[model samples]
Target: MNLFRHAAFEISVASPDGLPFSPAPEVAFAGRSNAGKSSAINTLAGHTRLAYVSKTPGRTQLINLFRLKNGAALVDLPGYGYAEVPAAVRRQWQGLLEHYLTRRENLVGLVLIMDARRPFTDLDRKMVAWFGTTGKPIHCLLTKADKLTNQEQIKVLRDAKAEAASLVGNITLQLFSSLKKKGIEEVEKIVGGWLNPEIRGEAS
Candidate 1:
């Protein structure tokens, strides 16, 4: 993927009678609130507002699906943890996320976005467990790489790799910064490979 020309749009599930099935291969982006998931997607897709940018954390309450030119789908899942949403609304997103992650057919891999400064939180571990159960490739994206020094970024990557190893066997970690546009090429290459039919292992 060029990382500069992919077209994307928001997707909504009008009815909950199971997810809207799409034949396109799907790769999901998931993380905690304020983890920069939307920013990462917008960076990769080369658009400022391809996905919804919300000021309130955990405002993304839907499993957003963006179609790529290669007939693949980029899914943006709701951020988990510490959202001030109502109990019932939170429960709805929780179930929706669980169902999509565990049951979606075209789900090829998961891009787990984590704040580079706080990479290995409890919520991150939980996501690892969920991805493990699904038996899909988990790509650990350490976002905000530009915010940290080079030494700190290296340390964070090392620690995240160790933690992910214990949680999920097949995992890949990348240093990313949506603001600086760092790691954009690397990530786009990985995503392009994952969307391809031949590459096995993880989408690193």
Candidate 2:
């Protein structure tokens, strides 16, 4: 079954304590501010307004949860690396992220998004490191891939894969373009495995 198609907004959490005690495994989508994380979620959902795409970076300050009909969930974490926000707020976000990544028992994996033109910024590396310690799966989606040439895209993909090889956990990556709807099925298939009862166990 198409799990993403069954997705619906569940909650928006600003604090770690706001996270619900869900038994279903969660797949968290994360990225730098303006890296098309929300757009990627909407595209995967096959719904235009499923996730709010904002022009201003750092606008998504809450951890938005989308529940699937099967009970599994997709989590949209607040984007990092935008400095216009207050320093204290950034620190708070850091703490909230750390707490959720390490303490959320239902979280099964992470889907980190990055711009294809500039993959693996400092904050991205830090996020990868933080989650890698848990030894969970991490799949990076290189968004805005349509902006780059085919050759450029391949090079970025190769480099990103090579970098993932050195991370602590099972880190994989692929080229994705929300604008062009590229790799939508492949991503959905993978994420679907995590949400499907009969197949989620095999996903790990």
Model 1 lowest lDDT segment of ten: 10-19
* lDDT score, candidate 2: 0.87
Worst-scoring 10-residue span by lDDT in model 2: 195-204
Best by TM-score: 2
Query: For model 2, which pairs clash?
Result: none
Number of clashes found in candidate 2: 0
What TM-score fits each model? 0.90, 0.94
Off by over 4 Å in 2: 196-204
Model 2, 92-182: lDDT tens digits are 9899888888889888889999999889999999999999998777888999999999999989999999988877887878999988989
Candidate 2 scores a C-alpha RMSD against the true structure in Å of 1.7
Residue 182 of candidate 2: its Cα lDDT?
A: 96
In model 1, how large is the Cα lDDT of residue 147?
A: 91
